[model samples]
Target: MSIEHMEQMETLLPEWLETSRLRTGQGEVASYIPELAKAARDTLGVFVADSQGKTIAAGDYGIPFTMQSISKVFTLILALMDHGEEAVFYNVGKEPTGDDFNSMIKLELVEPGIPFNPLINAGAITVSSLIAGDSPEDKSQRILQFFRKLAGNDGLDYNMDVYHSELETGDLNRSLAYFLKQNGVLKDPVEDVLSVYFKHCSIEVNCADLSRMALVLAFDGVDPCNGEKLIPRRYVQIAKTFMVTCGMYNASGEFAIDVGIPAKSGVSGGILALVPGQYGIGVVGPSLNSKGNSTAGVHLLERLSKEFSWSLF
Candidate 1:
């Protein structure tokens, strides 16, 4: 980013964030996960970073939250890196389901019995199973190490409170895994796969960490900070495609029309977005809209994308 652009953002972000924060009152923090319900519903924050590492931040950018479904994007990329596209796609389809992120309606209605896409809950569990490891602990460790590398932060670790909460309350996930097992789509034990899945979702991060991770994708798998190839270009392509199609739960099409960038949102109220070769953006607002997206976070992204003409379309 240019110096002038950086200055512009620094001046405007605070005002813009306050405007977006007003929308937080219109939504509520996610309560289904028990632990996610602990977030402060009215808080909002954002961090934006460029390939050269220039950063602009505002609001509660330092507050920590779990990655939730946002982790699914990197997990899918890791699965692709482990088994290639053909092998990974054999277990999950690439199309959006249009149902709730956790709905199993299509699994029963759709043919082949595999998930419609990897970003959804069932599909993410399937992808978790595909992560190469001798045990669930090993698979979870691999995912953590990969995320740390992508974020340029080795201190990244799981919020075990959230992990145990999800594990205890993840009945729907267990159902999905058992169904996949019955359909011959899962090879590992159900609990083992859920262990890996829950652990990844519970990985905690703040806005800066999310921006650094998104920066790698913004530069097509290369870490501009160290000139390292963190992920294969082809796998990044697949991950970005999924983010466009299913990243915002079922509100993806609307997000694309309004913000026009690849983004993934987690129920923890975090959204990781990228502007191709330009910037990586991270947003958080614990208050969630009806579609399970961060209300203030979405509003903020729309505002910035419009002001900067950041839409890919």
Candidate 2:
């Protein structure tokens, strides 16, 4: 971002955050996971970072939250890096399901039976099974290390409370894994795959951590700060394309029209977004809309995209 743009954001983000926070009442904290319900319903936060490492933060930006479904983006990239495109795509399709991220109805009804995309719960579980590892523990460790590297924060770790909560309450995810196994889609045992999947979802991060991670994607897998390549550009292209199409659950189309950027939102009310070649953004609003996205976070991003013309479309 330019100096003038940074100054403008510093001046406007606070006011915009307050304005967006009012939308919290229109949504509710995610309760199915149980632990996520503990987040303050009215809290909202954001952090914006540029390639030069300059940053602006607002609201409850220091608060921590789990990555939730947002972890799927990286897991998918890891799977691609591990097995290449043909092997990865053999396990999952490229189109959006248009169904809820967790729904398994299409697995039975849809022909061929693989998940339509990896951002959804079913596909992520499948991707988790594809990670190259000798055991579930090894796979989870690799995922955590990859995420820490991308975020430039070795301290990044799981919220054990959230991990246990999701593991205990993830009956639906287990069912999906079992179905995939039955369909010959998953080679690993069901619990083994869920072990990796839930651990990655429970990985904890704050807005700043999320912004740094998004910054890597913004620069097409290169960490611009130190000029190091973290992921292949082709894999980054595939990941960003998935982010634009299926990152927001079933509300992705609406988000694309309104925010016009590649973004992935998690049930913990975290949104990871990037203005390609320009800025990376992180937002958190524990209050969630019906579509399982952060209510105020989406609103804030829409406003920022319009104010700054950051949309890719």
Q: For each candidate, how many residue pairs have backbone atoms clashing (under 3 Å)? A: 0, 0
lDDT of 2 at 295: 93
TM-scores, each model vs. reference: 0.99, 0.99
**lDDT, model 2, position 240:** 96
Candidate 2 stretches with Cα past 4 Å from truth are none
Per-residue lDDT tens digits of candidate 1, residues 16-43? 9999999999999999999999999999
RMSD of each: 0.7, 0.7
C-alpha positional error of residue 61 in candidate 2 after TM-score superposition, expressed in Å: 0.7
Report lDDT (Cα) of residue 144, candidate 1.
Answer: 99
Whole-model lDDT, candidate 1? 0.95
Model 1 TM-score, all chains together: 0.99
Report how far off residue 36 is in candidate 1 (Å). Answer: 0.7
lDDT of 2 at 68: 96
- Per-residue lDDT of 268 in model 1: 96
